[model samples]
Target: MHNNEQLPNQPTGCGQFDPRFLAQIRRNLFSEIGANNAQGLSKNLRQQLEGLPRNVRKEVVEEIGDQCAALFYACESGNVETVDYLVKVCGASIEQRGISMCSMVHEEDWYFCTPLGGACAAERLPVVKYLLELGAAVNGSSECGSTPLHIACGVSRIDIVEYLVEHGANVRQRNHSGETCLMFAVLSESLCGYLISQGVDVKARDLYGRTALHYAIEGGNSQTVQLLLEHGADPFAETRYGNDPLQTACLTGALSIAHYFIIRYNYTAERLADTLELLGTTMIDTSNTQAVMYWRLANQLRWAVPRYIQKRPEILPRSAFENRVEFSTGADLDAIAVDEDAIRYQGLIILERILGIGHEHTIQVMTDVGYQYEHSVQRDSRKCMDMWLLALQMRVQKHSILHYKTCTTARSIVRLMENVLHRNVTQNDPNTLRFEDVFAMFQLLVSNILETRHLLSVQPISRVQQDNHDNTVRCLTHLIYLLLSTAGNQTERRLVESSVRDLLRHDIRCVRTNESLLHLSVSRLKMLESEYVVDKSGTVGIFPNVNVTNLLLECGADVDAFDRTKSTPLHTACLPLNHDREVVRALVEHGAHLDRPNLYGDSPASLLAGNLANDVVLGKHISLKCICANTVVGSGIPYQGIVHRMLEGFIRAHEPV
Candidate 1:
């Protein structure tokens, strides 16, 4: 290294200390301190401090003043004679506050001033002894409420910690967060050993109700955790979240610490079994089946299947049964190949096994492929009825399929639907008449079949009596709506009208009641109108039969049902955005809440805002009721009157906006 004397000076133009001069002082200071001078010569050399700027000089003086004030710091740090000179000649004083140098001394300074914290950190003995003998405060706290003992314990400085404890440093001094020295020790192995030697309280808890053992387990320091347990840290201590250390360790995948707790705390096999069972149950209850599988896999890999069997033999049998199927070596067909009705059932079984095997990417590919196939089938005139039936069957089967419980499975199914819908809308063809018929059929299936099934399944059976006759009537009503919506030939129209009249006279009294199902029905009805409602006047009747809307309302459907935009049925119908106005009028008559805003902040009135003629025609008799009364109105006013004009002028003048 170059000597400080050879270094270049700071430019005069800088108007700061010569960088070279400062560098030389720094070099000499470090060298002098490292030399641990034993004579008065070092003190006489202090005159060199005058060469620095006044501000720099003050800083150096304050720094040296601390050194001079804590003479024992020098002595404890093995600078005996230099400390003597500083104390005797420099007027260094020893105050009752221990080193008493300055409040500026940091936590790291405690380690440097004396060997107590350092020796504890490094497991040194003689250095610690000299410091203790020279009146070093073994229990002195730094800015963070950390004592030398805390430092020693935190870093596993067993020997220094023991030395400090023996010299009367309080073993129980808590830090800013009420974590005691023993708790700090549990953060590291060496400190744990030192605290154990000193008989420190190991069972102490922090402000968060976390005991030393909890920290050890949470920190995944297995050796420290074992030491804590050996010293009687409570294994059963629970955090504010009601989770014991073991559960926390398990959740965080700290297997070593978890095992230590289990072994040392005498955690029973039955208790472990119960924990696993509860974990699985909670996963299902919280819709976290993915986590359930992860935990199960962890238990298998870490402890081995034998241990799992010993805990819960039932899982082993289930696992064995599920994995019994043999997959083909190199199957390379697209996912849609499995969409055939005969193959779908087998494919579902195979897919469930694939999921169990954890081939997640493969499952995703299969779901995507299956969705594409379903879309193609819907768009093929010859395959429309088959596709609809297959979709209905697949949806029903999903409810019974255990595989669908996982979030991944649910997400895959949703992606499948989205892909199918996109493909169907893009592939419209005049030759595909049956394909055109599929949209109306889908509406019937979703509204009449799916909704009724879900209602019966979810409703409180004990609270209501079932009527088989009413079910038929409802089914017939759905068939009539489908027929009218798909009215192509006069024959089909007459058949549908006759069916509607017959269902209207039926004594059965069941009506559609589920919102999602109702939305599905309306969406399907709208799709039908889009495909087949062109009229002689060059106008499109993209409206569902008015009777269908009336029937839905009678069955307790909200006439003003909103889309994700909070756009009511009337809003959807009235918007010139390619929808049916007649449908909008029908919904308005049936008591649809017109004021509900969509996600876009547009209400029925706002949706018609751009169409002055339509707005004038509809706005006169419309209600201004809001879904959420406290809702703020948008910027546009209903009307601009004289009062509004005066307010606008006053506001503009005051705020200049």
Candidate 2:
């Protein structure tokens, strides 16, 4: 009773068994018997006969060998010879597992509890081949409906894949996970290359709709990318996440992959143009100083690239218009068929170039367009003009205002004033002057006119009756005095003096009552006398008739009035070391306070004594202390507070000590 021996009463001929098949089955059964009992089968003849058919049953009964069962056991034990013998000699069903109880089990279902499944899990090529020889269906399902090929692929067994696929394994078959063998190959680069060479579908996608190409891009594998692309994988194919391969490459900073997609792949012309434009604009937006540099480089490459400029000849070549220029000269001008739309588009491109360079070229081009086709360029021409004007205005105003506020020293102011005067002279023509220069000049001219008018209206006895008349008078007088002292030429001086004298005799009594008029009158009279020593009686006598010094005395003009520098009238009048003496005498007799001490501790008497004779009695009754108190109080709170505190401290210190 060998384990592999056939049973005599086994139902073999019951289901269409041919003699050749039965003989082969019997031979396999005998082979299994020999291997199961290595010592040899039992010698008793009745042992083999007990299960044999009876004389009547012998005609119908055919014995089936135990080869399949023996081979299953051999595979479980990893016995190579026994499994091979059973497969070749027995003619046992290759798809059958070992005999189970009373029936033969299908090899496909045997994976439920068999060591054969374990062999497949270990990725043993021998075990896979042995099972296939014993009629193991290559595409047969396991317990969970996964074929052996599926299990092999999941384990990334390249050998198993080769063996199974060679032996008619279904490559497209999926497991319960809905993943094919190709997906498994994609998980391993070696496996992927092997499968691709073996004709595995590289374009196959998984349950997530991601193809092998998608995975390669996501992983940023340059080798895999090149392989897939070489095999006709679409570079422009978007993933399930809606990102194209190029975008993925850029985002991952995969330079190699990006270069392949951009340079090797035949991307659409429009898409290439748009992508480059976006890159350029984004780089510019992110930087400040080097924005133009980046933009120009980007655009240069974009234009030079044949894909972007093949059809746009207007933008591509400078000689395109030269041809048209010659053609237009002929009598029959070929219908003058200019592509205005194309020209406009080219204009936009030129504009972008101009903005990037930020040079005079852009302005020149725009100006040329305006001049060449002024009537036809109504809308664009106006826009160009506005842009030029705005740019110029910004440049000039920024320089002028910044200099005036930050650098107000005498030397700097003088230089700035000289520059302004020079520009005014040089750029007198409105056509030649930039908008910024014109704007600055307009402000200056308006300011001068308003000041001149105000001075004429606020002069004493002038007819200027209006609601803000006092403020008007004060502002006008101050402006006139500044102009008189700082006027750049004789024209400015004459204009200031004329306006001052007109206001001095203005019919309006309120204007006549303004205290600033008397000060302006004396200043103007002195300027007239200095400018014209012999003919000074004309304008200078106007002040003498009004008697500014007397008028100021009546109007409570502090003779020792000092500005922030604390210079008294006498100290200021005696500046340059040689002013007219009659003007000084008039100021003195009209109650000019002579004993007033300025911030520098110099009295009007001391100021005059330095240069003028100290014994010159200009006034009879001069309250020196009153004059000093008036000037001190009018000098603002800091100076006034200092004087009061000093007096208080003196009285307290003397009383205590």
Best model per lDDT: 1
State every prediction's TM-score relative to the real structure. 0.34, 0.25
* Ten-residue stretch with the least lDDT total in model 2: 100-109
Best by TM-score: 1
How high is the CA lDDT of each candidate model? 0.46, 0.44
lDDT of 1 by residue, 570-633 (tens): 6555566534455555566776655555566566666666764463355544544332121222
Q: List the residue pairs that clash in candidate 1.
A: 120-157, 156-191, 565-598, 565-599, 566-598
lDDT of 2 at 455: 47
Candidate 1 Cα RMSD (Å)? 21.9
Worst 10 residues of 1 by lDDT: 528-537
lDDT of 2 by residue, 1-657 (tens): 443434334346655434453354345444544455543233442233233334322321223234234444445445555455445433333444333211111112223323244445555567667777666667866444566666565566778777888988877776543556665454456766777787767666655455667666656678777788778776776655445677556434454676677887677654554344333333322342232333344445556656534322233332212212111111212222244423332343433332321223233333333333322433232232333333333323332221221111111212222222333333443222233332333333233334444444443432323323433333343333334334557775555445445444442222333334444444433222111012222232233223434444444555644444454455555443334466567667766656555566665666666664444463454555554444444553234244578764422221211
